[model samples]
Target: MRQKIIAAAIAAAAVVAAPQALASEELNFDAYRQMLADGNPAELFEMEGEELWTTARGPKNATLEKCDLGLGANVVVGAAAQMPRYFADTDKVQDLESRLMHCMDALQGIPSAEIINGSFLKGERAKVAALVAYVVGQSKGKPIQVDLAHPKMKEMYAMGEKTFYYRTGAMDFACSSCHSQDGKRIRATSLPNITTSKGAAEGWGSWPAYRVSNSQFWTMQHRLWDCFRQQRTAEPVFGSDVTIALSTFMAGKGNGHEAVWPGVKR
Candidate 1:
């Protein structure tokens, strides 16, 4: 079925004339995505995440059912949509992955270093990816509601905004270089102007997605890490302040837009 869908999409794309190919290709890609929605591979990760959330593991042999994701403990619904918020317990603004790390340590006695130092889609980091998949799945179609009321959150946002436009690395490329404008494409992928709210939402909300090209699930942290790699900048530590700050900036800008989390990407 998936192959058939892909073939159909390819056939549709092949008929476009050279002058209109780019625009028509994008439309066909959207149609292909819609056709695959019911069978997204992310669902498998979501199931794994749900099991991880409920099962006892780590040193303490306790479950993360009580983990607070910016809402009250054990509240799975709509919680992710409001993340990257200030948590008084830590006295810092944290995104979903960082907060989950805190909960794993506090509630399950899992060391943060295990996840931070691990490779993507391997060992503990793989579990984190699955957990992220499950958590964000619940917030699908919910409005993005990241709050920047706290001083820490505001500071993070400022840092994120600076980071977005700050040019560095060998290529002297900032995130804004690729994403600040409309009608930009890197190969077949459309670059969203994340400086705008709609673009921010499209950029921020549709992450922690499953990449069809690689057949692997990626957390937002992984996404940012890759972005830095592409820009030839120093890769930030996993769940580091800079990554959270960037997340805060995008989430704040994306407020009120619907989340399309656990999204499937080409």
Candidate 2:
């Protein structure tokens, strides 16, 4: 009986120590991230993105250097930080990818259908991702200040809040399921609670990032689509209103946070 008691005490102590072990393991992860940061692979994509922006390839044979990103044509610097904002031309709240499609079609004369219909990591779609990285790099460390004052912006905000809490997947999992809780991780990746300002900034500010696992750049739209896939939910169309609305909600929550667009990720 004394031996049994000793075994039970040992098990209890091990259980009590588990959390500390987990924390140390997590700190080691930070070390890994720091190592990657020394030679971030995103630099390669940034170079490619810059080239894609200047080299003309569409049927019209025009470079995207003249494309207007809300501020004005040829104004590439610091544009990514102000995105997912209302555009007077669309008279709607459009996110970065949708706005890029508009520019690609109108300025470069690329077919909107062709651009929007393609997969994210392939063909012209890949080029779009690269271009996004290049533009977002131009705004690194800028403050995230997406405007939400327009009438359409207000409407999108309301819809986004509703969607954030809406649960309809096979697992009945909404984004809030993983993100609402603090100190949670999935497959060793720390999950930030994006409903609050700090969490939102951490989550939202590091997008248009380069994903090393895929060896490709991911825009916000691509990231959200992949989330839905992981959720076992129906895939949303690229640049759909729901996606853009969610972008507005996240970006708004991240207001005043420093931009780290084109961020490097594992």
Candidate 3:
């Protein structure tokens, strides 16, 4: 018993000397992420998006400057800060990308089919990505301001709440599976817990960001769709109800968080 106690004492001293061996692994990329953010490539996309908003195209050939984004028509500033709101015209609660799609088709006379069901990060889809960067950039440093009062907005939020925890697909994975826990990681990527307001704000606000890992900017819709794919679930149709619902959920949770997009991420 004396020998065993001595060995235990030696083991304890060794562990004390190397606390890192027992410490939880925390792979922080803050420095590298900051370096990438300082010179975000999304700037280029935002420039392109500005041009798209002002230029005329499609069948009717009208500018999207007349678009109504839940504020007033032609109002670009700070509109993104309050999106995923109820739009009376469409009578639907739409996120930034979905609202943009509506305006492009209505004001620009672009066909809805042209924007929907296209492969991501290519051609028109790529153009849409740039536009997302520009519009969301308008709300930079402003707080997330999703409105929850309207009945429709509340309805969407409820649906979103349900969808967030609805687990399925081959992996039986849900957004909660990844985002409900803190300090969890898959490989080197730290997963933010969106169940909490702080985590949700950080995760939601730092999007429409330039992804260093893939050399592209990802809009909120693209991010959500990709999340589904990663979960081995069916590819969610872009701007579909489920997508919008999930966006509403995240955006609502992130309410009051300052928008800080064009984020740089690996």
- Give the winner by lDDT: 1
lDDT of 3 at 209: 81
| Candidate 1 TM-score, C-alpha based | 0.89
22-74 per-residue lDDT for model 1 (tens digits): 34545335664554466777877788899899999999999999898877999
Candidates sorted on TM-score, descending: 1, 3, 2
lDDT of 2 by residue, 177-245 (tens): 889888888877888798898788878888877655455567888989998898889989888998988
> Top model by TM-score, which number?
1
Provide the overall lDDT of each model, using Cα atoms, as 2-decimal numbers.
Answer: 0.85, 0.77, 0.80
lDDT of 1: 0.85
Listed per candidate, the RMSD to the true structure in angstroms reads 5.6, 12.3, 13.7
For candidate 3, give the lDDT of residue 49. Answer: 92
lDDT of 3 by residue, 8-90 (tens): 54344334433443253547666556554545667767877988889888788888888888779878789888888899989
The clash number for model 2 is 0
- The true-versus-predicted C-alpha distance at residue 179 of model 3, in Å, is 0.8
- TM-scores for every predicted model: 0.89, 0.86, 0.88
